[model samples]
Target: MGIVVALWAAILGALAVAKYRKEAEAERTRIRDMRVVYELQLSREIAARRRHEMTVESRIRRELESESQADTAEQVAALRHELASMRGHIEYAISNTADPRRELTAKPHGDVRELVVSDNAVTDADPGRTEQQHDQDVVDAEFETEYQPSAHAKTR
Candidate 1:
């Protein structure tokens, strides 16, 4: 009878060990599945964040390019205006002479007033202002009065 009781006790101990091993395996599997789910969520979140950052960077780049283009356009417009002012000055100088090409190329020998239209010689005989100063003043006045903004310039 004692031997029989000992054999029964060993059998019950073996069954208990097997049941514990099965439960442990099931717990391990549950933990592995949970870890996989968390990793997937983390990866999705990281991808979303990266996409947002890229979108923001793209927007900033576009804005910078637009500003650069606007600056370039403004500079072009200013250059055009300066060129127009210079053209008006040249036209004023040319119109005052009897022979535009000859007077422009020739040197003044006898009378400086005859070769070039001097403000001091023609209308304002201001003794204070020299011939060069009068010429500069005329140019300044003509630039102020005759400088018409081009269509592109007016829009700016």
Candidate 2:
């Protein structure tokens, strides 16, 4: 009977130890899985941060690059092209609007006075004197006669 009881106690102890080992192994597996998940999450976060940093760095680099006139000659050429285009437009408009080479004479002054035409020698003045001078003299004489003050107004 004592031997049977001891054998039964030993069997129970072995079963308990086996159960404890299984539970410990399960806990270790759970912890390992949790560590794996944490490591994966950390790796993903680091990659995202690196990507963002690279993007921002590229944007900053682009902004700095824009400040420089790297293609100075090209830009100048483009501006010259634009100026030439504008000149072409202006030339086209001038050519289409009127005769570009035609000389434009200034309009003649108003003919307010009537001159009598006579083939006979009218005035023996210098031939160098122009008709405009004679007309101005005639206009002065006409203004004196036309704007003469009334006798009553003149006395006042």
On lDDT, the leading prediction is 1
Question: How much does each candidate deviate from the true structure in C-alpha RMSD?
Answer: 12.8, 19.9
Residue 79 local lDDT, model 1? 83
For candidate 2, the TM-score is: 0.42
Which regions of candidate 1 deviate over 4 angstroms? 99-156
What is the C-alpha lDDT profile of model 1 across 3-107, one tens digit per residue? Answer: 999999999999999999999999999999999999999999999999999999999999999999999999999988876765665566667654312333223
In terms of TM-score, which candidate is strongest? Answer: 1
Q: Tell me the TM-score of each prediction against the true structure.
A: 0.59, 0.42
What is the C-alpha local distance difference test score of each model? 0.69, 0.63
**Model 1 Cα RMSD, 1 decimal:** 12.8
